[model samples]
Target chain A: MSQIVCDSSSIISLSENCLLNLLPRFKVDFVVPRSVEKELVDKPLRVDEFEFKALRLREAINEGIIQVKDVPGVHKRAEQILAEANSLFTPRIKILHEGEAECMAMLELTDVNTLLVDERTTRLIIEDIIALGNFIQSRASFKLRMDREKAMALQERFSDVTVLRSTELIAVAYEKGLLNNLGDGHLLHASLYALKYSGCAITKGEIKEYLQLLK
Target chain B: MKKEFVEKLKKAFLHGDARGLKEISNESAEQAVLSRDKEMVLISLVSYALYKMLTKPHYHYAPGWSDFVKEVVSHLELCIKDPRAIQEALGKRLIEDIAKMDKLHGRFMGDLIERARVKQASRAYAMGLSLDSAAELTGADRFRLYAYIGRTRIHEEIPARSVRDRYERAKEVLG
Candidate 1:
């Protein structure tokens, strides 16, 4: 069975939309780092607003639908990635957080080449550093200094990692006929938008195109 | 925060200058984007709440309005005196106080703060933080943030590979 490393963003999105069942249906191992489990289950469990969602995720983990894995050297690797990625722009804003860095580290140290993340920043950092840098500079009021070499190095490290969002996962499920019972005509369309509103980083244009292709 | 900025913020609070507070909030948000300082982000958020409290007629006439404003002003005075030690706590306390006010009065105050958070989170996303990261920093709901973000051109500004290609790639990998 193949394994895909999960991040907190995707898990939270999936959980919020009641899509955690899709994990076991995939027949692939869905693993999260320890830190991600804290974000998904531990921390949220304490807050009243998110307590129910946290319980759902915790139940999924308890039932063995989602596995929690701790890989060696992940912390050290995460720190290194944080240092390099954080320093990529002058005036050094912390673009990546500890949870994201841990996810990247888990992807690097393990054999899992596929990363299931819903956030655009990590996906952009891996897939297109130049574009990410340009986007950052465009958003900032002050002129930003880009460290090209650092961006290049980080990109090279994550070059082979395949990034996918919760939206795609739901789309894949739709294509596989798992969503047939949810209503046929508008199921795919509604599901895609549901994921988008639930924190998947897919664009409206992208959803429109998906409807054209998949419908 | 610089002493000058704190002083200005205090002056805005003292004078009930909603417009000035809004401007400070914008300036602080920009600084947060550049510096990635959580304190700056908090300042932006608190300033925005203050702006709303001052400008919104409902909040002004609400019960305990005077006490709340006076308390916030006192907090600002402390912030001016020792920003490093007091700013983050003041920001958090303001949010908590607003929550309490909402409970005591009605849901109106809570709605205002939620809107403020969503607005600030949108600004953060526009200023280049990922949707999730921005939401994390601002305590905004990701669902609401994405909904707000979808209506803007931020997605267009940073185009990604086509969804079809990415979908095909996802199919290949997951299969």
Candidate 2:
């Protein structure tokens, strides 16, 4: 089966919306790196508000629905990506974290080319770094600086990668009749919005379009 | 941060100047976004929390309010002297103090701090950092941040890739 490396953002969104069942329903393998597992389960298990969500993720792990793979040499690759990606902008604020880096490392080191991430930055970094820079510049009151060569290099590195949000996954599930039991007419609409509110980096306009296409 | 900014922050906290604290918080938040400095983000969050405490009638009149204010002011003084050395300590101590105060007074000061974090994180998001980056820097929950961000015009301002194209790609990849 084709594997999709899962990031904590997508898993959290899925777990928050009680969509873990969709993992097994898909024909592909749903894999997460060890660091993402820590974010999803280990660290969150100690916090009261997130304990139940952690438990739900842990249960999915126990059931073999979600596989946690500790990719060897992942740390080195992650650090390299971190250094490269973080340095792409001047004044060098870290744009990526360990967990997200690990997911990317796993993708690079393994056969996985598709990353299931709900966060906007990582997707933007891979799919459209220039647009990402534009978005960041638009929000910044001060003049934003970018190293064009580094941006191009980083973008070239991950050009083959496919990024998908939980919203897209839900839309796929809707198309495949996986979400039918939830009721027909409004299932896709409600699920998409739930994923959005739950932290999927999808716009309201996109959700409306999905509703129009799928409905 | 500049010495003047630190001094102004110290003065604001010393006098319980809620408006000044609010303004400083906004300034700090903007700097946090520009510099990507975690300390600036913490300062913004702490300043906002202090502002809320001083402004809320119930919190202002609470018995331990003066004590809490004094503790925060002392931390700010240390920040003025050595911000790099004191920022982390101030953040930890502020949380500990708020937790203690909440327990002692049956107040929601800890929740206030959390709200301040989410609000500051949203501000960071609005200022141009990605939502995840903002939440990661400010220690805000992504779920809460997204909920807060959805209420704003941030998403509408950015041009996103076509949903149809992305959805098609997702289907092909998964299949």
- C-alpha positional error of residue B156 in candidate 1 after TM-score superposition, expressed in Å: 4.4
- List, residue by residue over B39-122, the lDDT tens digit for candidate 1: 777778878877877776777799899898777777777777787745555666777887677666654533657777788888
Clashing pairs for predicted structure model 2, backbone only:
none
lDDT of 2 by residue, A32-83 (tens): 9888788778876877776887898899999988999888999999999988
Docking class of 1: medium
True C-alpha contacts between chains kept, each model in order: 0.42, 0.49
TM-score of 2: 0.90
lDDT (10s digit) by residue, model 2, range B68-136: 877877766777777675565557887677656656654553376678888988887665565666778
TM-score of each: 0.90, 0.90
